[model samples]
Target chain A: MGPVPDRPATSSRTPADRPATASGPGRVLIAVYAIFAVAATSRAAVQIATRFDEAPVPYALSAFAAVVYVLATFALARTGPTWWRVALVSCSVEMTGVLVVGTLSVFDRAAFPDATVWSNFGMGYLFIPLVLPVIGLLWLRRTRPA
Target chain B: MITGYAIAVAACAAGVAIWAFVLVVLHREPEKPLLMGVGALEALLAVQVVISVVMLIGGGEPGSMLTFLAYLVGSLLVLPLGTVWALAERTRSSTAILGILCLTVPVLLLRMVEVWGGASA
Candidate 1:
């Protein structure tokens, strides 16, 4: 086996040299994003596969949200101007999706007999869906390349 | 889904999460004690997977076998993966990541219970 790598010094390199979008506190953010990516994707897959006919609107919305999450997670982890644009667009769309779905679910309960991840502003998810994009946008702005 | 074991896992996960939170607040890197706590929780989760699989083999019918098994595997993966991710960047945020990882275990457990035919609101 390879030698055990040094843990602290190598890992704690100064943030100036690291890509701002995925360094330090941003790592934690990315971790959270990754969790959401996996969760949403699996949920949408299961919902679509098992009961799409029962609630096609909400299940399709779930699939769309899952795709957005996967894209956002990918863009956030990568480095490049193109990836930055991708992240920005995905986060913006996510914000809009959550807000629109949230409101529609509330006023049009008949439309969503089953809950998508964004229903009621992601109430089932402790509102992380509603909040994550705000944080993502702020992180992107703060980490914009000079 | 054994309610007692699920509660135990939840309690231990909560403890580990609190420990991770304390490390983050102090601006300390993840250390041995935290890793040990995670290990303990991982052990519990391993047992949970074994018991669940055995029960399934013994004809316990969950609402959806695939979802239940997915959650079981996910619970096993979270800690070790999070620890690797945290160690890859030993910073305050890394500890926060561990906290997030620990917090997710209880959520997974709850989902497992729900998929195993428990009540869901």
Candidate 2:
């Protein structure tokens, strides 16, 4: 196979000329977000289908996280001012969700009968979920994909 | 997962992962060997999935068949995902998308083994 790259090499460009959010390091972010999108979606599907009545809060939250992950994945991968802002908003929501849900899950154990991706600030996920959006927002800011 | 086969897959993936990582660390473009190595590793993963499918067809049972199947299917999907990564600019970050993906297979296999051993959900 030819080693052709879709975009030209970026070694000569300054940070200010960074292309769309889906290129360069943004590709890595998309890779990770895609993983979480699948992970959270599948987890929620199983929980909701089998045991929704048992613990609706965490299950619903899992689904919500899944949607956010999906949205963020697309928003980051797609190019446009609109998608860039969508990614920004989605990452903000993700950061807030993880922190708020994480704190609540800690302070009130009874509230969350089971764990969502954001539970305990994603402690169960080795806290990658906690860190992903933080990096995502920063990446978005730094790139400011136009 | 047979202990030997698991070890083989993990070892192969480790070599590939390290190579990919070294490329990232050194800020090098993906050379022929590394991309070919990914192709080889993917073939190994495919064999692994086939083995699992055979075991299931032969009456082996995982605790949660759905989850087990999902992991199996998901494991095979890394190649397609890599296609996207490959088509992008061969930047260090772009290359790392595949490198990070190489590490997931062993984890997926480990999780599959747990499910096979009757861990649920």
Q: Which one is best on TM-score? A: 1
Residue ranges of candidate 2 with Cα displaced over 4 Å:
A1-18
* Residue ranges of candidate 1 with Cα displaced over 4 Å: A1-19, B118-121
- The CAPRI class of candidate 1 is acceptable
- Whole-model Cα lDDT per candidate? 0.84, 0.83
Q: lDDT winner among the candidates?
A: 1
lDDT of 1: 0.84
Candidate 2 DockQ vs. native: 0.38
lDDT of 2 by residue, A46-141 (tens): 888877999887899999999999999999988777998999999999999999999999999899878899989999888999999999999888
**How far in Å is the alpha carbon of B120 misplaced in model 2?**
1.0
What TM-score fits each model? 0.91, 0.90
